[model samples]
Target: MNSNRVRAVLVAVTAVASVLGAPDQATAEPAARGGTQWKCGFYPTPGDPQGTTARYFHCAYNHIMIRVHWSNGASHLGCIEPWENHPFWRDGGNVVVNAYFVPVTPRVLIAPSGRRVCAASQPTG
Candidate 1:
């Protein structure tokens, strides 16, 4: 998609995320083979990038929490890293991403770690 379209999509995703900000533990999905599936805010959006440290997207549930840090670069798919919590791996300009609550099911497996998405995100217009 083009930059403008990507921006619009990102905005829409974040907008939809308003209602998904904090999911209830009662809504946690059933665990499968120990681990369950997780999702993003609909569309990927950039988190905070400044100061001495970098902020990331994260949530807490089932006594487990995950954090998705914004990548300086872009990839095709979201990510298949050691952990899949990243929700914002898109390339946007000055995006102020809001926070959301995270929940977990159960698991004892390791995922890949590195660049999240394989689809490179161009600068949003």
Candidate 2:
């Protein structure tokens, strides 16, 4: 409980923190925009009169798999193969492979580095 002991403890903590190289999010630079962005598209299903049943999002990265969180409350840790367009879907949406049908597109997306993208180009229907 002495002044010297308190000083020594504070110094040790500072040293450990410096050695660990803790990052400060407030001062951290935002992640650069890159290929992790999703490209959404619609495809027709076989024997369907409407011809616009399939809906999906494709994302690709050159080096590593990127984890993304969709605005529709879906979090995915996929997109593995490098430079390949991996398909992802929104939560509670329907696909042609099944019986039920519910199509919805996410308007916002978040990446691992705290980078976010608002998909204004996506259809609002």
Clashes of each: 21, 0
Q: Give the least accurate 10-residue stretch of model 1, judged by summed lDDT.
A: 74-83
In angstroms, how far off is 76's CA in candidate 2? 3.4
Candidate 1 lDDT over residue span 10-122, tens digit each: 44553443334433222343342145334443333233242212233223232223322234322121211122244443344433233333343222221132212212222
- What's the TM-score of each model vs. the native? 0.23, 0.23
Show the lowest summed lDDT stretch of 10 residues, model 2. Answer: 77-86
Measured by lDDT, the strongest candidate is 2
lDDT by residue (tens digit), candidate 2, 66-93: 3333343333322222222223232245
- lDDT score of residue 43 within candidate 1: 35
Q: Whole-model lDDT, candidate 1?
A: 0.31
Which pairs of residues collide in model 2?
Answer: none
Off by over 4 Å in 2: 1-63, 93-125
